[model samples]
Structure formats: C-alpha cells, structure tokens
Target: MGTGVVVRALSGRYELLDPLGQGGMGVVYRAHDRELERTVAVKVLPAQMLRDADFLARFRRKARAAAGLSHPNIATVFDIGEDAQDGEPIPYLVMELVEGETLGDLLRRTPLTPAQAGQIATAVLEALEHSHGRGIVHRDIKPADIMVRFADFADFADSQARVKVMDFGIAKLMSETATRLTSTGMRIGTPAYMSPEQADGRPADARTDLYSTGCVPYEMLTGRPPFTADSPAAMRFQHIYSRPPG
Candidate 1:
C-alpha cells in the first residue's frame, strides 16, 4: 500500500520495483519482468475499485481494448493480468518503459515555441487519428500523458520531433459492450483538458478530442491552461462559452 512496495504478479514472474505515480483510478509502477529480462511500466487498478462491479468490468474491457491498438506513437502494451495475491480481478497492464521526460515536465522548464508545439501536437494527432479510425476515443489527453524522446531534429530543410502518447486507460470503443462499461454522472478525464461536451457529462467523440488537443498547443505556448476557475463546473462553462486568450 505504501510507496516502493514490491508487487509480484503472474505467479511471481513479474516484480514491481517502485511506484511511479498514482491517479484517481490506479497506481503506476516501474517493474521488472523476470521472464523477459527488461524493465516495464505497470498500471494496476486498486483493489477497492473492484468493489464496484461496473467499474471493474469496464476497466478490464478498456485494458483489453487498448491492448489491441498498435501505433508507433502510442505506448506498446505488453501484458494484462489479474493480481496474483487475492485474485480480486485487478487489471495490470505491462507497457514499454519510455526513457524521457513528459511534456508536462518539459513545459515547466521552457515553454514550447509554435513550431515545437506543432510537432508534438502532430504526433498526438496522428495517434488519435489512428485510434479514431478504429472507433476509439481517448478521454484523457493532457500534457502529462504525452512523452517525448530523442530523434533527428532536421532532415535537410525540415525539422521534426518524435513523440509518444501514453495512458489509454479511459479510452472508449464504440461497441455494444462499451455502453455497459461506463456509468452515469461519472466524468472520466482531466478538467483542464476536457472538452465542453465531456465536462458536461456528454459522450466524447473525435471532435471532443480535437477540442482538447486544440488547448494543448495554446498551453504549450502560453504556459497555462486555456481556462482557469474555482471549480470544475465553472471551468466547464468556460470551455463551452469563453474564448481563450491568444
């Protein structure tokens, strides 16, 4: 339960090293795969979340659905399994460990120019376009979810950067089974990056993601979210009605 707890999974084949971070839904860990002899990032759902059968079922379904998405700009999912201890049906996803700073951290040190921001945005957009073509909508697209790695900056007369998107935990697939996975009044996304429709508890579509992405470049350039307010409700109204400053 505490930080740096070693979690063994798959009958003691995988050993988690340390807690990378924790969010509302789950905890991410840096772990080692004994079978593969490599480091991996593991996302483990909390045991308490399993108490809500709907949330548990939906979590597993979403994990499986995300595993099916394969793109160079998207994190690669390696494995999915339940906890080895209690068998409470917690879904843990093994992902390739990326070795670079997150966009959030990068932005804190230096604001991105329009050219740099566009390159990163283009990579995210390509991943979204790929997922959307398969009827998947990523509900979370904040700066923290974007990862950047070293790549060639220019060819001859052009400049580019390699970017990767992580954490597809809240992705929604357009399928009959997906409807049962989501609950009412449970908005699943970061308020700062959520679209107007998403903040209003409406189902998110490709357009919603587009709106969210539109905010990212602005934040990268200005070093602030598009809107700021005292509460999530107020932010929602701003997202729906106000024009962000340039």
Candidate 2:
C-alpha cells in the first residue's frame, strides 16, 4: 500500500486507518472491520521484515502463542493475515482495541499508592496464573506491558481498575530477534525487570516470569525498578548478582 493511503485487508474486509504507534518490530494501526462493523487494532511487520525467513517463522510463532490464549486480561487476537496489496507481503495481527493507558505511562505521571499497586499486581498475577497453567510463560511483564482500564472497585481495598497484560512472548521470537530489530545490544525484555536466569541468557521457565512479576509491584509502589544500571550489560550483571533494596 502507498504511504497515507487507506487500504483494505482480507479482500477488502478490513479498512486500515491512521496508525496508533510504531515499535521496533511492528506498526499498530486503528482499523475498521466492515464485516464486524467495529474498530480494532492491527499490528503489521514492515514489508522488509518479511524477507527474512527466520523472522517470518518467529512472527507466526508469536501470533500462534497469543492466539491460543483466551482471557479477558489478555488482549484478544482476532485474525492474522498477510497484506495482498500488490504482492508485498506485510504480515498483520488483528487485536482488540483497548481503551486505557499503560501502567508504565500512568506511573510516569505519579507513583501509585501501595494499595493501588497491590491491586494491579493481583490482577496481573491472575492473568499470569492462567497463562502459566497452560505452560505459557510471559517472559516479559514490566509495567509497560500491563494496561489499566477504568472500572469500579468500591468493595475492595485495591484500586478500581481492570488490568490487561500485553506482549506475551512466544519463546524464540523474543530471545532471537527483538534486539536485532532495534539494533540494540540489550536483550528483548527490559533489563531492570529481567529475571536472573533471563538476564544470564539461561533458559527461562514460568519462574522467570514470576521474577519479573515481583519487580513490577516494587516499581509501582517505590517509583523505581528494583535494580538500575547505566547499560544493558551492567543491568544484567546486577540482576545476576545484586540484591534488591529492602
């Protein structure tokens, strides 16, 4: 498709509109699906990324991993397809359009109270519990990867919000390519929140996500990640050796 041109996908069923954001791997666009008659989010890898056979394979793997999951706290994957516009293959993923700010974005404005942060962490743990039960480890669970939607919670001591986890990794997809696409020496998962095993480049399991999960609430309540470093390598070293502040 041409720049600034509105194009249809899946044989003119979905209409693409202005982009929502661009990340290292894909650009997300707000779109309309005539068949469903509702707004949705579409994430697409640039046409150039498609040329790499390995990347394409990993892309499909990530899509499948997210697609297999079904939970309210997890973003819903609606469809996966390649653009048929003029033979340029741009792979795209259709997802539920969430209306809220990321936990990271909210924290930047002001830190949350302990009670509020605890509530958010509880919701995230609920989501993680489900994924873990199915043998899926999120691998990346920082504040930026968590979404908070407005809701009522008067009965509970926790904050009134619904949490949604974003960007659950599909094994090798993140381990191999995320940093490569960004031209950064750092690994895919943010350094501060990375579990020791992940930071050390050891194979990760469900416990890896649990380690990152512990880091989220620390930042939420304290306004900083448990560890800090000037560089990715330094951060990895801290994760492997330093103890978090009490």
Candidate 3:
C-alpha cells in the first residue's frame, strides 16, 4: 500500500483515482480495478476504526453476508480486502461502479414529478422486499444512500432513472461493533429518515426499512423530508414524537 490522498491497494490491484464521497462510515473512491479491467467504487474505512481484532472479525463476517445479496437495484459488492499501510490494516470493499448522482444531489436541483417519484419508490420497495426476504434490514435509507443510475451521466436531471441502494449492511455493521460507537466516531443511522424504533435505539426489523421507504418518496415528491431539524439529536427526537407533516 502507498500513502497520501491517492494510493493503491491490494498490491496495486485497485488504484484510487479520486474520491466519490465521504460520510460517517468511510470515504468512497472512484477507482480502477486492474485485475478486473473495469472501474469500481472502493470504500476505505478510517483505518483506526477497524483496528481491533474482534471488531475486524465482525466486519468481515457482515461484509461476507452482504455479498450474498443479489438484485438489479442493489449495488453489487464484488470483493473485500485489507490495505495494510504501515501495519495499519485499512479495510475496503469493492463495489460495482455506478455512474450517476445521488438522489440527494438530484433533488437539490429540483423535486421529482409524481411519475418519476413513483418509479423511484417502486424500485426502492422492490429492493427492500428482496433484502428483507433474505432477512437483511437496511437500517439507513435516505436520498444520499440511493444512487439514481444515469442512462447518461450528462443528464443530471433525467426525468426517469433507475435507483441502486448502497451501503446495505453498513448501519448494522456499526451497531455490531464490539466497541462503543463513540470510539469509531460514526453515527448509527441517519436521523431524518430513520424509523422511530431505530431513532430511539430500539431493535429494528424489516418494517424499519419500510418506514424509510415511505419517507424517501415523500421527500422526492415534496422536496423536503417528512421532518427536519437543526441537529441530529433534534431530528431523532422529532421522529420519535412529532407527527409527520401531511
């Protein structure tokens, strides 16, 4: 492994070209997979977060579980490996390279029409149905986590597009860590769209994702989430107490 803002991993099998995005979980990069001869998305977790032995085992187990999922609307997880930089094992997951802006970015430009919104909702529900049937719950489902796959990257505001759900088991992985969440500096779930049970630190099941499934389409149709707040804690509170706007 190399060092600095851009680096290669797994003995140069994947070359980090540029960063796609960063969040509470990790930084995702647009990368070149030399072995496969195709572009891919690589999520490199913050090195220190997965350093512990027990947590590292859990991370691999969960990643392997997510890899079993296969669906057209679910971003495919291709492989997982560690990039040991200076003996610090930084783990990464290779995913299908989806070329499109996030639904969050698309909505920032304009809200979707009912027709388009319906399409996205249908796809998301189908994706959830498939995952739920397999007993996997996507604890965090929001616009940012949904990729609106482009027929063409140039058409940022396409009226119709397919959606691919990303980060399938990430929230579950965060919660399963042997260490406290404070140690990893990662939020367990996104607040505004989280189910009331999830927001309150209660056990979440398939219904939790269905709750967010409804929330995302509402935001797509209305240009705003069902609830909003000045802080993460406040947003979670609203999900627990305040009724959703009608």
Candidate 4:
C-alpha cells in the first residue's frame, strides 16, 4: 500500500486514512470511524509479527491489558480487531487521536523550562503510578512518546500544559501468565531512554520506569539524551555504567 492510502479496516468499522508513522512493532494510521463519526489512531501489527506465534499471543494479551487501563494521562484504547481484507487476524488498537506535538518535536525548537519539564514529568509520573498500581510497567517512557497539549487559549497565563503518555506496546504486566511471553535476549524499548537494569537485560519494575522517567526531564533541560555513544551497544554500556550529565 502507498504511504497515505486510505485502506479499509479489518472489522470494516473504520477506514484508515494514511500512515502517520511506524514504530518498533506496529504501523500507526490515521483513520476515521464511520459509526462514531470521529478520527482515531490505529496501530496495526506487521505481517511478520503476526506469523510469530509467541509475538501474536503476547501482542493480544498486552493489547487487552492496555485496553483495560483508563486514565486521563494515558491514551484511551477504544477498540481491537483484525484486518478484514486478508483475514490474517492482525491485531489493531484504536486510540483517541490528539492534535498536538510530541515532546521530541517540541524540544527540537525550544528546550522546556524547569517548570514546564516538571509539569510534564508530574503528569507522566501520575500515569506510571496508575499503571503500576495495575501491575503494569511502561518499559518505554521517553520524550518522543509524550504528547503535550495546551490547556486553553484564554487562560494562557495560568494554564499548565497537559501531557498524554502513548505507546505501551512493550509494557510488562506483573502477572504469572506474562512471565514467559517475552522472548529471551530480546531487548525492547528505546535505547537512549532505557533504564540501567533494562539495558543489562534485567526484568524491569516500577523503579525501572522511574529511571526512564528521569531521562525525560534530563533531556528536556539538556537538549540531549543522558547517555550518548557511537552505537547501540556502546549506548547500552553507557546506560549501564555511566552517570548522567550534571
């Protein structure tokens, strides 16, 4: 399919408009819901991933787990279904579409002030807290996954920006069933924002997410990731051993 082609969804409830972007595990599309008369973001797994039994099973489980979570700071998952054309049983997650810039995009032009960073950080922290309470750890918590929206046009002086956390595709749930879901030596999550324990291939917990959260504010203030290296391996090493820049 072409980059921006409007493809019909598998369930036929929604029609995908065009490709918004591709992530590690899935391709996100901007789609319109005919029944609801609104726009939604759809994340569809790649064909290759669906063929992998382990990945497909875990993907469904994770999607279900994420769908059960409801929070203002977290993106709302509306529906899950397969593609109708191929009957490949591909799992696609429907999410509320927010018209705002990512934290990464905003940082490219101007670094957030300490107060601004704090505001964003607090919202993410709240999200993590809620997810953690549900026995879920957001393995990836980087600036790129954070969506920032202005509070209001009139209350500019007193308004604080709102933040919505996205992309829980790699989230690990603290349940017995999920123990064997993740593949061995298959490191997930963004390298630059990975926690030390995660970089070392250790099972992550809430603290691991907190460590990743720390990287966000650091990047917001410094205009760069806390760890830097020549390659992914070198970056992993830095994450494991080096102290963050002061």
Per-residue lDDT over 1-246 for candidate 4, one digit per residue giving the tens place of the 0 to 100 score: 224565565477778888887644557888999888999998776554554556656766777788888998998888777664445666677998967778888889676677788888999999999888998788878887899976662454687887899866444432222334345322344589888897888888889889999999999888899988888788989998889878
Ranked by lDDT, top first: 3, 2, 4, 1
Can you give the TM-score per candidate against the true fold?
A: 0.84, 0.86, 0.89, 0.86
lDDT of 3 at 32: 91
Candidate 1 scores a C-alpha RMSD against the true structure in Å of 4.5
**Number of backbone collisions per candidate:** 0, 0, 0, 2
Query: Distance (Å) between predicted and true CA of 149, model 3?
Result: 3.1
lDDT of 3 by residue, 1-246 (tens): 223358545557988988888766677888899987899998887655765567677777777878889999999999888777777777888999887889999999766667778888899899988888888898888899899854744554664577899888766776455236565465544577989998888999999999988898889887889999898889999989998788
Q: Which model scores highest in lDDT?
A: 3
Error of model 2, residue 215, in angstroms: 0.8
Off by over 4 Å in 2: 1-11, 84-87, 152-159, 171-175, 180-189
Better of 2 and 3 by TM-score: 3
TM-score of 4: 0.86
Question: How high is the lDDT of residue 228 in model 3?
Answer: 91
Question: Between 1 and 4, whose lDDT is larger?
Answer: 4
- Cα miss at 224, model 4 (Å)? 0.8
User: What is the C-alpha local distance difference test score of each model?
Assistant: 0.74, 0.76, 0.80, 0.75
lDDT of 2 at 229: 79
| Model 3 worst lDDT run, 10 consecutive residues | 1-10
For candidate 2, what's the RMSD?
3.2
